[model samples]
Target: MKNTIILSILLLIFIFNTEAQKSAEVISIGEKVTFFSKTLNEERRIWIYVPDQTSFQKKIEKRYPVLYLLDGESQFYSTVGLVQQLSQANLNSILPEMIIVGIENTNRYRDLTPKVNSTPFITFLEKELFQYVDEKYRTAPYKLLVGHSLGGLLTIDILTNKPEMFNAYIAIDPSMWYADEQFLNQTISQLPKQKLTDRKLFVGIANSLPPNVTLKNVSKDKSSETRHIRSILKLGDFFSKQPNKGIQYKQNFYENENHNSAPLLTQYDGLRFVFDFYQSDLSEKDFQDSTSLIVTKLRNHYQKVSKGLGYSVAPEEEFINYIAYDALGKKHFSKAKSLFILNLENFPQSNKTHAAYADYLAATGDIANATEFYEKSLQIKDDKAVQQRLLTLTSKGMTLTESDLIQYVGQYVLDDYKITIVLELKDGKLISKVPGQADSEFVPVSKDVFTVKDKQGYNITFHKTNDTITGFTSVQPNGIFKATKKS
Candidate 1:
């Protein structure tokens, strides 16, 4: 009896340890570093986050993609969290796990800009900053450069002159026309008729100037600032008209978000555009039924758009494959696998697609195929999180349990706006549906707090009186709406 009790205690401890190891781990807080600049001859500071590779599986050994961000002090944490959450959600697999470098500014004008006649400091980025980052980090050839305001101007300069430096570029409210109207007009004249190949650029314009402001050259009343804004828009219009061959370009005009509030919206939209293929809206079923036909149709569609717009559409396989993985997360296994195979034909380099397919294989108890694809994904990109998830799925058997139905349905009303949320139980899962939107399965984050993986823009919480739900609050992207359940 004594031996049996001791053995039972040991078994319990082992099980607990195994379970703990299977859970996901949060990314480590990034480090701050300051380096001497050669261009401006001043010190520049930056924030850096390396993915949690320590937890990565031993089978995978590889470097990762790099993202260079401006406004390090203000937006670093938010961008990092967004990348992690988006990747975890697997929404269209639009983003890949990579290192993020946030460049902190010593003097905004000196480092972020390309030229400064009024300011004493020269452009640090042009002189020594870019070389410094390359030397310090284990960066890959595939890199994305992001900036806003003066930084945005620098991004444009790089795109215009040294396009080979980075794979992707994002500029938010760039001061492109700051050098003067003559400089912008000259730049437009010098633009090449041919499209840039194998490159991507995203430009965002905010609601800084009123809509009534006239931009024509013949305008009688013109201020220097107005001319500046006009020049930037003119350049935007130019890019919009250019042919699509080697380059993919997009422009976003934010009427609601001003210059100060534009960064958040721009960052999200810019990333989405650069990774457009990964964030496609196609359903997994679409890919499974006819992968070849879908790819052909998409290619033809892009060819037409490219000819008319002067830029290439995102690769079809990447978009389809990402959609498949997303479907799998919602428990559609066969659909996910079919999409993965289709995507592999187009984007053989995408490791995320393989990893997602591996997950589907594991779910159906196809251990051999699951292991193969898991290793394949790791080979392309060393993703530790995926490896850990695989280990959990394989080792501990998971069982789905149904929960009892509860009454928590009601109409939520706020000032000037109304949102009706219906709470229903389906197969033991609490599902919430909003009018005109798709139903979302909510996972209880807390006793009364529930979250939907499908929607990041809102938070839904319920208030209960005794065993009955009395009221519920619906938090949206812009504002919050509260409603009491009708008695």
Candidate 2:
């Protein structure tokens, strides 16, 4: 009887544990959450996955980088699966663990593009939608933006107009010539002559169009059967000629893939490009034994690849330089400085290397050199966050009193839609808040001009009426609106 009772208890415990495990995995691979959006005039749905690390003890303290995916309904499962496999793969530690936030499209044309035309089914993605996601998620400052097809075009638009919106950008077969080539031409004209700082951009092109299709004939067939191969080629050439500096960029033409088939291969290649060094076979021993020898060998390898592809070296500094930064976080300043200089030598135009070196110098009390390099880094790109840091350091003795007029902000109501703005202070900095969240700090670019550090590519302008900060305007590529202080 005693043995039988013990066996029964064991069976019950096993059943209970099995049920618990099944319950934990019950959430669909791409579960959707409805978020209220004034920009879309309705509740917007987004797909999200918190990493499965919650089940592991070692991963309990880890916070992950966030990857905002475009076309969530279509690509979320594939990307989430890819991220999980690649990050955990020993052969390709090319990507870190990241929280995948798939932004579902209620209207792709409207939310992704900066401008809205008379297109029958289009939606716009203003600051309202972006703020909603950030407030609702535990996002890190490090972010990667991704898109494919029309989504790819949207990715380019976001990076070009608001480079600060994401730390890295990946676009797969982006429709470069869409909207009468509106975004393409705009990007070409506004392509900054200076280097981008601490930024990485990767674009891929594939045999997406059917044979012999041209952009000029796109209007002839409105059936979505037409492929604009010529236009994609033109875009490829344009991106190829774009100068490389603070931004490390590359373009790949997948001869074997079409527009629909391109995303899979392009995504793999793009992630490799973004995190090249993470997959390097180098070990600590290799660096310690012969640092110069390893760098030389790597340089040779880069040269061969660049020559074969008719392009320059892959921006090795962008990925390799992170090693030094990681070391510095542990207070190994000397090692960090050495790596920073090496990265600068490899990628002279990269503003990140310079900025990182400046930080190292500043930490060591070498103020003059630090200031010089910091200025040089700023000259590469008009990044608002970098500008603010430089301002505080340069004007060390200046006492600046900034107020959060963002709080007295009000709603911009458009018919059935409403946008809520809140202001507060955090970490000794003034921040703007949208509905459903608290305020975070804003980085000032110029006098009365400020932007978010994570980019999101928003500009907040305060309005003064009768000597009171009564209103403000938040501007993005989609549209502009004036919000008055709510009484």
Return the top candidate by TM-score: 1
| Residue 343 of model 1, lDDT score | 64
Which residues of candidate 2, in runs, are more than 4 Å off?
1-30, 53-58, 89-92, 116-136, 193-195, 209-227, 280-487
| Residue range 113-173, candidate 2, lDDT tens digits | 5563322212234365456556765555567888987888888777776777677889888
* lDDT of candidate 1 over 80-112, digit per residue (tens): 877766643433245655678888876676556
Error of 1 at 97 (Å): 2.4
Which residue runs does candidate 1 get wrong by more than 4 Å?
A: 1-28, 53-62, 90-92, 116-138, 193-195, 211-221, 241-245, 280-487
lDDT of 1 at 480: 74
Residue-level error in angstroms, candidate 1, position 364: 14
- Write down the RMSD of all candidates, one decimal each: 25.3, 22.1
